[model samples]
Target: MNLYRELAKEQPYFVLSDMQASMGMDAEAKRYMSENIRSEWFLGMILFNTRLLHRAIAKGVVFAAALTRSPDDPPRTKIQFVATREKALELLEQWRAQADGGRG
Candidate 1:
């Protein structure tokens, strides 16, 4: 989280997270992290090589984002789950293009 805060000091950035070897988070930790994430500086994130359970949890987070975010606020972090690194990179490129106003 410190790293994220430091990076946010510069500019909004996207994260390509490789979760293949991750031990996965519990509900409490997930809630804490989600509550702490500042949408103003988090552009988006792609989780690649995640386990099936993690993918399902990611989907829930996406749903929560849609429900909790206000229409008046700037875009929140867009989270995506992919099976492979190549696909993750492809999606990241698309996100970059979108963030760049289609200039990327």
Candidate 2:
């Protein structure tokens, strides 16, 4: 199953699908992050029920088509998409460093 991980001090975060728009817990999911999680420079990619991808994007979060039903991206979108846990962390680190200023 997928999971949500908001790295401490990391500018980006990965929030698994079930955690965002599963049938019975959608509100709970958003609340968990909107309220519980706090950060100024956080880039968050929230996973939603495969079906919720379209709608979720309408809500604010950007969805790279490559991340829809699978954990891996094909090729073209891969450059714009960050799917794996490690890559997400790396992206976040880049964001964090940039936000801190001086060097990224």
Candidate 3:
């Protein structure tokens, strides 16, 4: 969470997380992180090579592709999950394009 707070200082950044070698987190940690996440901190995040349970959890959070917010609404971070680095990069490019007013 500290790392995320630090990263939040750079508001418009994106994250590409490789979770293949991760040991996984407990329910308490997951709840803590999710509840504490500041949606306005980052543009989007991609989690690649995640386990099945992680993928399910991610899907339950919010899908980047389905995000739709009015200018008057509060910010919501976009999150996506993929199986490969290539797919992750591809999705990140799409998010960048959207962020840049479709110019990316």
Candidate 4:
């Protein structure tokens, strides 16, 4: 858990595995989400090769920007689930288009 807390320091979102074929989401991860995330706006994108992590999407941080698709995965709405890196990047561009939206 300490490692994850340190990871949260580096970015708005952090991928839990390094070059693994897949990632596993567990209760400990959820605990970290509750204690670590704080987003006044949208949370950053998390690209994973697995569907088990979707449960984290409800953490109350903010937008996903997009979650790259995993076939056999269930349909997800209200949050974007992309099919590729290019698609995720495109969604990011679209999401930031409104920027702050407070200026005239």
Best by lDDT: 1
Candidate 3, 21-100: lDDT as tens digits: 55466768878876665556677779999988777766655543235445676655677888999999999988888888
Least accurate stretch of 10 residues (summed lDDT) in model 1? 33-42
Candidate 4's TM-score reads 0.40
For model 1 the local lDDT of residue 21 reads 53
Q: For residues 1-104, write the lDDT of model 1, one tens digit per residue.
A: 78888999999899887876566556687677666766566678799988887778666766666677788874677888888999999998888888889976
Question: Tens digits of per-residue lDDT for model 2 on 1-104?
Answer: 11223343443443333332345657666555444332222244433333544355324333333234244633221112334545656665665575569474
**TM-score for every candidate vs. truth?**
0.69, 0.33, 0.65, 0.40
Clashes (backbone N, CA, C under 3 Å), per candidate, total 0, 2, 0, 0
Q: Which stretches of candidate 1 lie over 4 Å from their true place?
A: 24-35, 59-71
Model 3, residue 2: displacement in angstroms? 2.3
lDDT: the better of candidates 3 and 4: 3
- Say which prediction, candidate 2 or candidate 3, comes out ahead on TM-score: 3
Best by TM-score: 1
The TM-score of candidate 2 is 0.33
Instruction: Please report how far candidate 4 places residue 94 from its true position, in Å.
Output: 1.1
Using lDDT as the measure, name the better of candidate 1 and candidate 4: 1
